[model samples]
Target: MSRAKRKIEHIHHALEHDRDYYNHFDDIDIVHQSLAKLNFDELSLSVEAGELKLSSPLFINAMTGGGGERTEQINGEIALAASETGIGMAVGSQMSALKDPAERNSYEIVRKNNPDGIIFANVGSEASVSQANEAIEMIEADGLQIHVNTLQELIMPEGDRNFKTRMENIQRIVEGVSQPVIVKEVGFGMSKESVECLWNLGVRYVDIGGRGGTNFSKVENLRREKPFSSFENWGIPTPISVLEAKSIHKDLHIIASGGIRHGVDGVKAMVLGGEAFGMAGTLLRVLLQDGRQALISEVEHILHEVKMALMLMNARSTKELHRQPYVLSGKTREWQEQRM
Candidate 1:
């Protein structure tokens, strides 16, 4: 199939399957403050990711582009939602757009709608400096996300098996681009070693698109000529991945993505040290299944929930949520104990 057609299929599959595959394993907790001494209206939600300042701590993450009319419509709707809500957004892998310059318009529609919003252009980690630059230029992105997905490639029939030069390639991109480079996991999650490597390479931002979310392996498994059981469940869990990344580079900005749902989950992510959160599957479902108004309502609902969570925690702002005392338990606690 052509890259563009594949792009739309991927988005549809992600929206349909993410809830079943990703949301089953984890839960987020919020510590309520009975003496919060503040009203919900007093809560502050503004936070910054790199040079981009956001009205809320959430962003519609990288999903799809470079397909045909349907793909353009999907991107346009997502962009419209982001623009209407005043949130940041990341377009899906621009490799297809890079391959066919004509497909660039599909991705560009995001910025065309969200003129004042923070737009993040994306490409695979395998992309060269020139390709990365062109992607940023095409979207006029405020930042760039280079997604690493060795697992997805392994399961993909057309996957790139040889990723030996990814580190060097990422380093070059970080050095070559003026924009802040966000090192993101395309669902396999980031290990401490990988986080250190990216930090050393000057990646000040990282997105732990951890395991407990979309199983790219499962996504690819469906397309396999012959089914493979080994690729079904792979990679680190969300909370554990965050702990690992924070241990190595405490100062690096981290955005938690995979499997995150609702306001309390967003609160737990911040308490666990994630500066921002990205929601794709849940938001995309509302967009694809219910249309743009539904997606906007869902986002607004989450924002209100997040603000209420902050008020309950007595957090005056996003930064305070990071420092608010909390503890991890269950599988997450056990994972951290073993890792630490």
Candidate 2:
């Protein structure tokens, strides 16, 4: 199938197969402060994720683009929502656009709609330095995200099998690109070793795209002639991934993604040492099912809830979330103990 058709199919399967699986954020509980001096109105949501400063810690993670007009509309809507909400947005992989100039507009619509918003360009880890630069230039992105999806590629019949050079490619991209390079996972969360490797390669930002959100393995299985349901529940959970990334280094910026459902989950991620939290499946579902306005309202509601969570935690800003007390219990704590 063509890349455009595959892109649409991926979206369709993702929306149809969307499930409310547990992401382990529930395993985290922030200890409440009764005599907190901080007022609710005084809490600030502003956060710095590496060099990029965001008005809110929440961002619209990498989703769709480069399919066709449908994808262009989706990207535009998402960009507008992100702009309206004062959050960052990352376009889906731009390899299709880089390969075909006609598809460039699909991804370009993101920057066209939200010209001043913090936009991120994305490509798979296989992309060469020139190709990565082309993707960044195509969208005028503030940063570039090189996503690694070994399990997803293995499940997808048409996906690439050669991933040996992904690390080398990422290192080259980091050195070649002037913008910040973010090494991201696609539903298969990063290990501490993976985080350390990226950190050693001069990568400062890492988006631990953990499981519990959109399962690309399941999506690919649905497209396969012979389905593999066994691989659907693979990879580390979002909360666990956050812990793993943080365990590597305190200076390493972690963008907690995967199955972040709401603002509470976002707050939990920050408290666990994530610089910011990203939502792709949740925001994409809202945009598709409800409409652009609904998506905007959803983002606003999430941002409001983040502020409320900070107020309840006796924190003045997202940076202060680490100073607040939190308890990790259940499977998440076990994972932390074993892994970290």
State which candidate has the highest lDDT.
2
For each candidate in turn, the TM-score is 0.96, 0.98
Model 1 stretches astray by more than 4 angstroms: 18-28
TM-score of 1: 0.96
Q: In candidate 1, what residue range of length 10 has the lowest lDDT sum? A: 19-28
Give me the displacement of residue 233 in model 2, in angstroms.
1.2
List clashing residue pairs in candidate 2.
none
Model 1, span 1-340: residue lDDT tens:
7787677667766655644343423544555678868867767899975675878898899888888778788899999999998888999899988989889888989988888888999999999999999999998998999999888888778889998899999999999999988989977788898898888888899999987666777777777788675866778877677878888866799888887777677778878888899988778877888999999999999988888888877889888987787766677777777887
Question: For every candidate structure, what is the RMSD over all alpha carbons to the true structure, in angstroms?
Answer: 1.6, 1.1
Model 2 C-alpha lDDT per residue in residues 115-185, reported as the tens digit of each score: 89999999999999999999999989999999999988888998899878888899999999999998999
